[model samples]
Target chain A: MQIYLPIAEMAIPAESIFFVSLFVGCLSGLFGIGGGFLTTPFMIFMGVPPAVAVGTQPCQIAANGLSGMLAHLRKGHVDVKMGAVMLLGSSVGTVIGVFVFKLLKYLGQIDFAISMLYTILLSSIGLLMLYESVSKLLRKKQSVKLEFNQFKVNDFVATLPFKMRFPKSKLYISALLPIGVGFMSGILASILGIGGGFMIVPAMIYIIGMPGIVVAGTSLFQIVFTTSFATLMHAVTNNTVDILLAVILICGGVVGAQIGAVLSRRIKTTHARVLLAVLILSVAVRLSMQVFMMPDELFSTVVR
Target chain B: MRIFLVVLMVLLSAPVMAQSAVTVDLAQESIDITTGFNGADLKLFGVRDAPGRIAVVITGPQREMVVRRKQRIFGVWANLSGIKFDNVPVYYDFALEQVDGDEESEDVEARAALNIVLAQSGIGLEALHFETEENVGPDDLKVFQGALIRNKQAEGRFPEAAADITFMSDTFFKTSFYIPADVPTGEYQIKTYLIGKTSVKDVSTTNVRVGQVGFSAEIYGFAKENGLWYGLVCVMFAIFMGWLSDFIRRRL
Candidate 1:
């Protein structure tokens, strides 16, 4: 059935919103990732304005992150100190991001900016996942062992000022490192409307030298805060958040995540990664076609 | 009862008959956009005492609008440049009264004559005007203006082809116009033109009020007026939903 969204000022099929969130939520639960990379673009394709889609996403992501954070917290894997420091950086980053977003909206380039950013981000991330999963599959067939030794704390990251100790991760790192990393993801989260856990989790383990066990928990911990803060900022500054849209998406997403979390136990991780890679890549390709292909109507009009 | 009501309306406004040859009234004077309002079809029936032909035009709620052209920038189509126009109607629709002709009209010449009359009286699309201080050349303005009309037509805000103002009887002519759900809420004019051979003989304008009410209005009003509280409530709602879902999952 069609439902009118007040702030977006449009009527769309309620099931379409629910199903998109459900699919993305399932993927996020199956893989330990925030699927905003998929959800935001899907909404845009479904005729939600880029600003509304981006603005409304944070609350849904915040809610999804909370569930995951709770699970991780129970396992005692969250390094709250590290997550807090990163959140500090992200808060500043989100402010800058929202400013840029508003500027782009005024210039009427928000659509292009969102589309372009998604194309670049989704493609690289999808390709990386595809490559890693394929090689791992091939290696298993040949029984070749993969090495676990990853990043060394480079002298530059080690020597930066304001070193802080995170007892949970058992690491001493420069406070600036997590802050800078958090800041980058925060900008991305605000602009792209993704929880940014996929990006932030990797950065936590590789860049900040956090323990792998704590990385997911810490990333989820910070995502809840950053997304909540970003939602507030966009709602206040841009007035773009569609609360009704968020409600439908969150309702579908949370349930889907629960089901996905249950199904993840039975499914092989490698195959699922490959499937997800394909999905992400397909979205990127479609976005590229939308941008590069000649439109049937070359002129678009916007009401001011 | 409906026809009787239509006649009664004409008789009530008969006192102004000497001042103008035409008088028009809508089925509804005001429309409330309650929750789930899609769009509204307005029944406007009129009387034109001295008319070679009759036409109805509806316009309202002027707004600033921009028509942007797409250009390939870095191999991607982006909205590059735009012509901003002032005083553009957010809603525009018009229809001509079909001359006494065959009901199933294969009468091309008769329709052509009607078009000629509409064009001459400036009662149709080509006569619509918009102003801009953007220092644009006439050709660029024409292109953007045509684009604007085309877009609006596609959106059903403007009639692509003239719909007929059908006559119910010798004295009463009625036509239906749709006000789209997305039409900006404001004052609108429902004008019935008494088209003479080459000019408008008499014009009668009626007022229409479209306003948003109910849940949709409440939500939008709250969001715009109290952004901070709305945002906080949205966050809280989402968090609670998340927590509830997780709680349900564990119990299951």
Candidate 2:
């Protein structure tokens, strides 16, 4: 039996929708995952129009991001300079992302392309995180301390003219790195309707070799502007930002993030990644089912 | 002299009857019509004073009407009762035409007839009208109207006071009432009216109070206005948690 929701004209209950948001919020705060990866697809499954789901997911992200950023800031883990630089780059990249989005939307191939990319990117990232976490757990008995090193390579990325110093991060790297990272983050943020903090955090930690402690805070700082710009742009152009729905999700998400952040400290580092992997895999499976399984009704005519 | 006096008294008594017997009752004087974001309802009432004729002249902020449907052979294959508004303060003007029938006849016909009153205010507006029945086919009738009072000049008056209220769907609507950063805090009335053939019915009114701005306005004002502050506050909370975790780890 199919039901219709008066709010979104989609078939979903208020309780289930609340729970999905809550769960996504918890995971985001606890594991540094962008809940958009989960919430967007979940909304689609519930029959919300894609544009609305994409537009509203950022509000939820904003809630989660704010909570995480604050928590990290208080921990003395935020590198303000690095974050600012990255935000500057990401903001510029966001404009490009919007243009790219318009082009793709005009081409009418955005949905298929986004879906395919999401499936591939999420699964690969999920598997990699899962493998790393599991391996770390298995080797937990060994007290291994990896040395942090700053190495310069002979590539264009390494030799970029603008070399900047991050005193707090204790690194002097080309400004190009932060800009490149921001550009990538912006593209992903716009395309995925996420803050792109998940990718940004990992990139800062591994690629830039920033301390793990600073990763969440730095990424969140950048996310704030990226998502805010995206929200504003979507509101002005598509007028799809529903403040009512956003408020409800934010209410639940803010509470959930606080609890999740407290819980994050109790869990092992590897365990957080494992949980994130599980979430990604589940979302992927659900999305794949929609693609493979026969839909109850096929839209023969185009809506737009 | 006695017959003249008797005739004068009867004439005075008859004139008194004609003056006092007629009464006008506006029973549905004040009614409130509350609608969700996208849905619309008709605010209607009867005018008893006007015995033979009635006029409804609705005037307010200007509005527009756009209809989306499929035209079928039988007519339009859709329900045409509940009109949708993309924006708020929807205004209209309606009038009633008297036929050679009794009050009962007029009542039955009034159900099907409606006058489309356009917005008089030169504000950009849009509207969609439909019949108020379920499973019934479309009415096949279209009403195009604008505001009754339009500002002749191309310029807008009270630029700061003007606000845009847009309906997102059935339950959610957004109004960007620009309280200029410099505007003084006070109580303002937001009024909307429903105009019928001969009467003016105020449908809805809301009072908005703006308070003194302070620190909350600086950090949270922007957030409160644009709804970004909630997220910013959440981030602050997460950082606090992160700190608490680190503090605990250090002690352990």
Candidate 3:
């Protein structure tokens, strides 16, 4: 059936979008990623206005994040203090990202800039995760339990001023480290219309040196806020957020997220990381193709 | 059958468009754009005593439109120069009278005559023009205009060709306008043109309002005026929906 989206001023087939949103939501819940990296392109491909697609992504991401976060919190996986610190930094980053977005829009190059940045960000992060996860998967299983401080980056982060304890994550790192991480992710999230979970998950494991099990839940916790902030920015400034579209997305997303949360509990950490790495890499590759490929239609018309 | 009967009643109530024998009545007073609105197919049936062709034109509200052409810039397909056009009607649907069977003897000649007349009168899609204050060359403007029309046609805003205006008989004719879901809501003018073998004999017009209705309409309107509060509501509503879904899932 078709549903008319008010802000987008378009009618879309509800069933197809529901299934796609469900699939993306499952991946989000499974990996604790916001899933915006998938749905935004899907909507745009389906002929929904790009602005509306980018604007509506955050609302559904928040819903999916909340559903997944609740599951992880129940199992004591969330590091509330760490998530809060990162949230503070991301909030500032989001504001900056919005300003940068406006500047790009004024240059009449925002569309190209977004596509280029989106491809670059996704591919780099995907490669980083793929490398780390593939190395861990190939190693002897016992080394998976190696001490967290083995990475020199952790040593540098540990030596920074204003150390804060994250009891849930079992780490004592400088607050500045996570805040800086959150700040960068925040800026990227606002600019690229992603929740920054795919980036943050790797950062938590390598930079903050958090354990695997804790990374998903904490990243989701921060995601719930950053995406929510981005959502607000889209609604307030662009007025492109379609509530009906968001509702439909959430309807499918929550179910998938719940199923994913259940599956995550059964899978081994290394396998899950590898699966996530594969998923992220595939999307990145597809998006890069979009940036480089010649479009079938070379002309477009819009009314401001 | 019920929808047709309802259409009949609405048409009967519509005010007579011309003092002459020619009568044009729209099926509905206004097109209601509710949440479930996919698109609207409005019926336009009319009677013309004059011996001529029947054509109906529905023009929607005008707005400033930007037509962008893409080019390979530094090996990347990007939108390059754009031509800004003002007072461009967002919606323009035209339908010409369809000749029935056994009319092929002069169908080609009749169509050619109609095309020449329409071109001279500045009617139909081919003659579409918008006065622009941009510094673009005339050649560039023509290219951009073609692109704009092509894009709009692809979006179902403009039909690829004039819709069929079927003649119920020699005196009565009927046509319909398929207003797309993405059509901007505002006052629309529905014009019925009576054309002789070589010229327009008469024209009649009726105004119809197309505005958003129902629950979703309220949200669209609210978002336009109170962006901050609307964003807050959207965020909170999404969070509540998340919690509600989780609650339901646990029970299942």
- Candidate number of the best lDDT: 1
- Model 3 spans with C-alpha error above 4 angstroms: A71-79, A102-111, A125-176, A208-215, A265-282, B1-18, B98-117, B244-252
What is the Å distance of residue A162 in model 2 from its true position? 1.9
Query: Which candidate, 1 or 3, has the higher lDDT?
Result: 1
For A160-183, candidate 2 gives per-residue lDDT tens digits of 778999998887888878888988
**Cα lDDT tens digits for candidate 1, B49-153:** 765678888887889988889998877899999988897888888887766564667877766665676666556788788788899988999999999999888
For every candidate structure, what is the RMSD over all alpha carbons to the true structure, in angstroms? Answer: 3.1, 14.8, 3.9
Error of 2 at B144 (Å): 32
**C-alpha lDDT of residue A201 in model 2:** 69
Q: Candidate 3 residues B1-252, lDDT tens each?
A: 644775465346444534554567777778888888888888877778767777788899999987777788777788887878897888988988765642565667777887888876656898677878989888888888888998988988888887988776667677888888878989999878888878888888898999888876898999999988888888997788777766765775
Candidate 2 yields a Cα-based lDDT of: 0.51
Counting clashing residue pairs in each candidate, in order, gives 0, 41, 0
Q: Give a tens-digit lDDT track for model 3, residues A97-206.
A: 87787676654566777667777776786787678778877884445335544663544665799888888877878899889989987886777777777678767887
1 against 2, candidate with superior TM-score: 1
Task: Tell me the spans in candidate 1 whose CA falls farther than 4 Å from its real position.
Answer: A140-150, B1-20, B100-122
Which residue runs does candidate 2 get wrong by more than 4 Å? A1-12, A140-156, A265-276, A292-302, B1-252
- When 1 and 2 are scored with lDDT, the better candidate is 1
In model 2 chain A, the worst 10-residue window by lDDT is: A295-304
lDDT of each: 0.84, 0.51, 0.79
